[model samples]
Target: MALTSIIAIYALFWVMSAFVLLPFGIKTHDEAGLPKVPGQADSAPANFRPGRVLIRATIIAVVLTTLWVLNYTYGWIGVDAINIFEKPEHLKR
Candidate 1:
């Protein structure tokens, strides 16, 4: 059940990203300026930089992924609050 839920969440991410994010121009690369490669003409717009929307979306996705991982393994809010690495010697059975 847990594994299935995780898979579903990831599936939802792709679905949401395609239908939701792509519409608003949340592109992976620069829209106006193409990235410079070796021995290439600078044909793209020089004034353009990475979009703020993409950056914010990426950050939000990472944060949510971390939270999901924490919730799955420890059933907690965050990973830092749960000391899963600390051994409880009494449970050595």
Candidate 2:
């Protein structure tokens, strides 16, 4: 794949990874035994850590993208492997 395509795929994976990692390692004020400020939502996180989130997202994205690249290189999984709608020759008769 082209460099631009790889970068784009990496960015997509990064964003997805961030969302997947968002709910992990989070603590609500109630969970942390901290008093919530007035108007604070009960489910709001006690703290936001962009740096940690970014680091985790980057790690996940790197692993995912590396696997993707390896699959592309080795053809480990192909379209035929996942074809659900295609009828077998024996069944089609």
Native-to-model Cα distance after best TM-score fit, residue 34 in candidate 1, in Å: 26
* Candidate 1 residue lDDT tens string, 1-93: 377776677556645544455445333224555576666554444443346445655665666666777777777665565669876668876
TM-score for all models, in order of appearance: 0.33, 0.88
How much is the lDDT of residue 46 in candidate 2?
91
- How large an RMSD does model 1 have? 11.9
Candidate 1, poorest ten consecutive residues by summed lDDT: 21-30
List candidate 1 segments past 4 Å from native. 1-50, 77-93
